[model samples]
Structure formats: structure tokens, C-alpha cells
Target: MAFVIHMPLTNTKAATRYAAELPMRETSPGHYEGYYTATSNVRATGATVEVRAQDDYGNTASEIAKGKLNIN
Candidate 1:
């Protein structure tokens, strides 16, 4: 099983690059999605997902999501 992460980008000028600690998927411009697949042998409890955004002008922003999912 896989958990999907959705991060919405409201401000464009402030965010030019998107990166996630997990695998990153670009659903569209300025939008990103990722999957949780760490510790395949153990069940995933409360996990934290971080999404970072950086602009060319050196501005940056980040968002974090924490939740528990059944992935056994």
C-alpha cells in the first residue's frame, strides 16, 4: 500500500522549486505529490512529510504534514 501526499502551491513567485524527502511527483506546475514508502517491513505509524519550495530569488517556503496511515 502507498500513501499519497498532496501539496498545493498558492504563491508562485515565492516558490520555484519543489522538493520532498520522499519520492516527488509533479502533478502540475507548482503542485506536487509524493508517496510514503519507508520501512517496508514495519507498519507506518504517525509519519511526517515535508515539502520544500524555493524560488530563484533565494526565497523559500516549506510545509509539513503529519498523519498515520495503514500500510501493512
Candidate 2:
């Protein structure tokens, strides 16, 4: 099985929920989902999301999602 991790982004509040490595639950095989309410407001381009994954075999992969923050 593979596990996913979300790296938290630093904020002005010293540390928010995004300040630690949050793990996403594997809803189904190979599918993971995570839900979190924003603790503070973010500008249209002020948010960054990083995703990482590791397999039971010790293989690891990571990526920083590149996109504008959609404040709607």
C-alpha cells in the first residue's frame, strides 16, 4: 500500500494545521482524500500545496502543486 502526506505551509499565526505533515486517508485502493477547513484567509496566489507519497517498498515521491489559489 502507498501512503500520502501533505506538507503544511507556514503562516502568520506561528503555526496552523498546515504547519505539520498531514496524512491523507486512503479512501480506496490508490485513491486518497483529505479535507481541512482553512484557518485563515489566503490571497489569490498565496497558497502552496505539496504532496508526497511513499510505498511499502520504501519508494518515495513528492511534488509541489503549482497553481493559483482560488479564493471563492
Please tell me which predicted candidate would have the highest TM-score against the true structure. 2
Off by over 4 Å in 1: 1-20, 23-25, 36-39
How high is each candidate's TM-score? 0.46, 0.56
lDDT of 1 by residue, 1-72 (tens): 112234322234454245223446568986777654334344444544556666679786776655644444
Worst lDDT run of 10 residues, candidate 1, spans 1-10
Looking at model 2, report the run of 10 residues with the lowest lDDT sum: 1-10
lDDT of 1 at 3: 23
Q: C-alpha displacement of 71 in model 2, angstroms?
A: 3.8
lDDT of 1 at 58: 77
Q: After superposing candidate 2, which stretches have Cα over 4 Å from the reference? A: 1-18, 40-44
Q: Would you list the C-alpha lDDT of every candidate in the order shown? A: 0.47, 0.56
lDDT of 2: 0.56
